[model samples]
Structure formats: structure tokens, C-alpha cells
Target: MNIARPLIQLVSWAILVSSVFLVKALANDSTQNLSIAVGWSKPPYVIALNDTGYEVELARQVFKRMGYSITPVYVPYGRTLSMLKSAKVDAALTLSENTATQTIHLTDSYIQYQNVAISLQSSNFKIKRPNDLAKHSVASFQTATKILGKAYADAIKQVPLYVELPDQRRQVGMLLNGSISVLVMDVNIFNHLHSALEPIESRQLVSIHNIFPPSHYHVGFLNSELKEQFNRALNDFQASQAYEILVKKYHIFQEALSTH
Candidate 1:
């Protein structure tokens, strides 16, 4: 027997055993660092720049309670799905049970967004529900087609000019200038960032249509066991006084904010 061949065989066996143990160790590690995928600069939810926003911090606290830490990966809303599917990241924020990402496990509804259809008051558009949007041009956040349900999806297809983009601030300008017939967004999101994002050229009154129901979003995970752990932690976090402080910190009320 060649001495080098036997030694190499021994080393390979050790490596294989080590890998198995490592996998088991990580599976049981409570202080694990998770790579979480989240979307771009939507204030009060995801302020991607400094890497700290309402949902971001909320996730941090929830994970912290479980002795886990999060490393947020900022991608566009649409990319979050792909990232999760490809296992490029560990989890995705703001996904719902309705999101069509196959093999992805979802947590309980941790956050709710009051999404609305907004148009200029001058247009006199009577958009009471999603189907009413079929006749007009619309701009909305990325993945709105998937998350807002089938009725909204069908309406978007009928619209002559419908656009969904990651930069929601630009869509606000489009709605104000009459370039787009409607802008679909969360009520708190528009309220928190409109003054800074709106164009100086257009100063127009807006009509908010509560066409869509409140969207309850969950965090997504590729690992099923991790999902169970997260849900347990989330339940504990929600019941704690810390959770109340977090909601108030972000100025997010349990009741929908007045859509004026």
C-alpha cells in the first residue's frame, strides 16, 4: 500500500465527519447569525440605507430574543423572492402566506400594511376596489402583482399603462404630475415620505381609495426548523412590553392611521 494514499484516505474521512458535525452544530446553535433578505428604502418599514428601519429593528429584536442575530441583505422587493428561492439568503421580510415562492416557509403575520390606490382629486376617478383600476394607468411597488391577490392582478393586466418599480418615491411624483392614473401604496408609507419625495412642479390634492384590504405580511425562511423557532420567538416578542415600545417607536398604530 502506498503510504501517501492511506494518509490521504484518513484525512478525507476526518473531513467528512467534521462536515457532518458542523452541520449538526449549526442546526443547534441558538446564537446563529442569519442572513435575511429585505427590500429597499420604504420608510417606517425598510429604510435600507443605514440598515435600520421599523421591520428591520423588529426582526432584530425577535431574533435577539432567540439568541440569534440577523444580517440584512438589502435587495429590491422582487429580488427578495429570487434570493430566497436560490438560497442566497436565509430569510425574506414582508412576504405573506399568499406569496407564491415555492418551498419557502412563512411565519405568522407579524406586520400589516394598509395599502391604498391613490389618484389626483382632479381626475374624479371612482376607484373603490381593485377591479375599478382596470381602465387607468397605475404605478405600484414591485411584486404588487403577486401580493395584492388575483383581482388586483387581473386589473393590472387590463390597464393600458401599468408599472411596478422598486423606487416608490418616483411613483409618488408620477401620480402627482398625472403621468400615472393611480399609485398604489401603503397609507403610512405615503404619509411618512411624501413631503420629501413629491415633486415641486406638482402640488395636487390626492384621493386615497381603500381598494385593497389590509395586507398581513410574514417573514419567509428556507429552513423549516428555523421557521418553527422563529414563530415561537415571534409569539413571545409580541406578547412582551418590548413589542409595544417598538410599535410606538415607529409611530405605527394598531388601528389604521387616518388616510387623509
Candidate 2:
């Protein structure tokens, strides 16, 4: 090859290598960034499909207070812990010690879900407690089995027909059409979907059973330092006016901390 041509080729290759390194350095700046695994479709808590929801906004605001930005890694509710354990994500939203194994550092309780059993009023389901679900067909939000406590877990095992769905919208529809006898969902989610998918006059069709105790949630972080930072930021943010506004923006109520 001509000397001049070879020299130009060498310079071009070096420049390309330098650019690649630069891009990676910027992209992998873990020190100033965090990737959190969030549920893909629990609207209100997480609508990770579009990345706008209560949990998403909460994480963004809390992490921003900690001098870092956040990127939500949308996954099924079941994958949040695994993703965090595998180092694929810096943290996982909407998880707690009960919903996890001994793998990561869990932040303080930052959110709560008032999980309840809902059914058609016509069904007359005598579901006054978790065990009552055993006699009926039930569809609940995915990960409910693990997060809803031991009593709920043991009760679901006795269910004649039980299923877990990632999005409650379908389960809500199932409950509405009498396909399923009961739906275990967050109250806010039930109300939100009910409003959107049915007529106001049809609101009386379902009965919401406030049987399950509220599920408190925390963020699982890969490292203790991050956990500490996040918890501190979470506490500070939850005490600020901005957090009040955020709660109002999402219309969170007493039982619907994870609003829809």
C-alpha cells in the first residue's frame, strides 16, 4: 500500500477506537447513574412500557435528590429481584424483604399497595379472608403470591383455580365478565381500570374486599451504599412539598399509595 494511504488508514482506525471508548465511558458511567428494574405494566405503580407512573416518578425524584439519574429497566414483576441479583440493574423497585431472597440491600419502605380481593357482587363470594380464595377461581397480580405474606401464600395453594397476571387490566376484565370468581389487585388499580373499562353506572357490579393487609414495598439495591443513599433521599423527598405535589399529581389516597 502507498505510505500516505497506510498513514491515513492508521489514523482513522485510532480515531474510531477512541470514539468507541468515549461512547462506552459515557454510557457506562455507573458512578453517576443507576438502572432500576421496574414492572412493565402495573399502571400507576409502574407503566414501564411508557415509563410514567407513581413508582417511576418516585424513583426519578428520589435518585435525582441523590445526585444521580435513573433509567428504568422494564421487566415483569417477577424479574425485578433476579435482575438486581445478576447485576443487570443497580436496583429494583416495588420489592421488599418478603418478596426477595438474601441477595440485595433493601431500602426503607417507600411505597405500599393495599391489595384486596374483588369479585362480582352477583357472585356473592364469601371471601372474608385469604383462605376463602381456596374455594373460588381467582386471578391476581403477578408476584402477589410471594409479596402478600405467608398466610396469603399458603391460602393460594388451596385455590381450585388460581392465576397470576402481569397486568390487572385483563384480570379486571375477567372479573367483570364473570370469567374469574375473584381478582386480587391494588385498590387504586381496580378503581382506575374500572373507571376506564366500564361505565360509571356499572360501578356497583363488583365488590372490593379489604381482606389482605397492605403490602409495604422497598427498593432492592445491589450495594449498601446505594441503599443508604436511596433511603436517605427517599425519606427527605417524602417529607418535602414536591413529594406532596407528586402524590397529588398521581392522586394517591390512604389505601392507594401506589395510585393508578
Candidate 3:
């Protein structure tokens, strides 16, 4: 009976050790790592330096709040949608509602973009409406036609000289060099690019018009459950001071205008 008691005690100790290790393993498994697709070198949104930007920080905070870790996968803007559709990434950030595919679930708007038409102050251009763009040479970001809506797309079709470039920087350069009479881009992005220019050059550029309405961007997710969780977390974030902090840090509301 003495040997039997010791044997039973040994078994209990072994079970306790096993349970501890099992719980630890399950804990590790419970902490999920989410991958998010973001555009490369899109300043104030996806800065490539340390993979830190407004959207990057926002996503990090949102997922962290939801008890998960996030990894941002940088890709070109055009490829982000395909990557999401193919399940290459858990979600894609900074996508407008007009651009989101039907198959993927979209979360609430986490960011807003003020897209505008820019031209040189010397050009004497006036772009009060989409139709007004038909009279000028234009350069715009890729997929902008679809995202800007059918009216803008139809207007661009009427433009005799129109080109869609993949890089915002190139569009800015083209506008400065007089290669394109007008450039369309987010106000923040234009400001970011303009800051790199010489003071003399910056003074000459101007945002002619805010033809396109402000676009609200959402995160696209292939998994519906993840989208629901993100929306809840995003709503909570918007109600918190953290959201205001991010907006101010990024200068999100500042309209696109000439530096001068």
C-alpha cells in the first residue's frame, strides 16, 4: 500500500506537468498573427523606413486591441487587391468603397483621402467639375478612374491627353515639368511630394480644384469573421482619443493647396 500511494502521487505530478505545458502551447496558439497588405512608399500612410505610418500604426493598434499581432505586407497599389483576393494577405488597407470587390468583406472606414486636381498657378486652369478636366492634359494614379466614379471616368475619356501612372511621385514630377497640365492625387500625398521640391518650385504648384469628393477607405478582408472583428475594434478606436491623435499626427484633414 505504501508503494501504491507513491506511484499514484508520481502519476499526479506527471499529469500536472503535462497540463502546464499543454496550456502554454494553447496560449501560444491563441495569439494569432495577422498579415495586412499595404502600398509601398505611400508616405504618411505606408512609410517604408521602419514600416511605420499612420495606417501602419492604426492597424497595429487595432489588431493589438483585438488581442492579435499584425504584420504588414508591402506591395504595389495595383497588386494589393489581387493579393487579398488570392488570400495572400489577411487584409488590404486604404481601399476605397468604390474599389472593394464584392467577394471580399470590407471593414468600416478607418481613413479618409481628399483627392484633388492640381496644376501650376501659371496654367490658369479652373476645374470646378469632372467635365472641366476634359480640356486639360492629365496624369493620375492607377485605378483612379474606377475609384473616382463613372462621371470622372467619362470625363477622362473625353480628355485628349490622359495617362495613368503607377507612382504618385512621377505624377508630381510631370505636373512640375509641364508634361501634364493637371495631376490628380490625395492632398496629403501631394503635400508630402511637394515638401521635397525647392521653395521656388513649390511656390509655382497649386491645387486647382477639389473635384472628387473625399474618399473614405476601408480594410478589405477575405474572411468575414476577421472583418467583423476589425469593424468592432475600429468603432471602438474611433470613439477613443487614440483615433484623434492619429488624425492630428498625420494632418489628415488638411486640404490640398499650394505651399505658397
Local distance difference test, each candidate: 0.84, 0.81, 0.83
TM-score ranking of the models:
3, 2, 1
Model 2 segments more than 4 A misplaced: 1-31, 99-102, 254-260
- Which candidate wins on TM-score? 3
Write one digit per residue (lDDT tens) for candidate 1, span 201-234. 6545678888888899988988888788889999
Candidate 1's TM-score: 0.81
Clashing pairs in 2: none
* Every model's TM-score: 0.81, 0.82, 0.85
Model 2 quality (TM-score): 0.82
Residue 153 alpha-carbon offset, candidate 2, angstroms: 2.5
lDDT of 3: 0.83
What's the residue-level lDDT of 170 in candidate 2? 89
| Candidate 3, run of 10 with poorest lDDT | 198-207
Lowest lDDT 10-residue stretch of candidate 1: 251-260
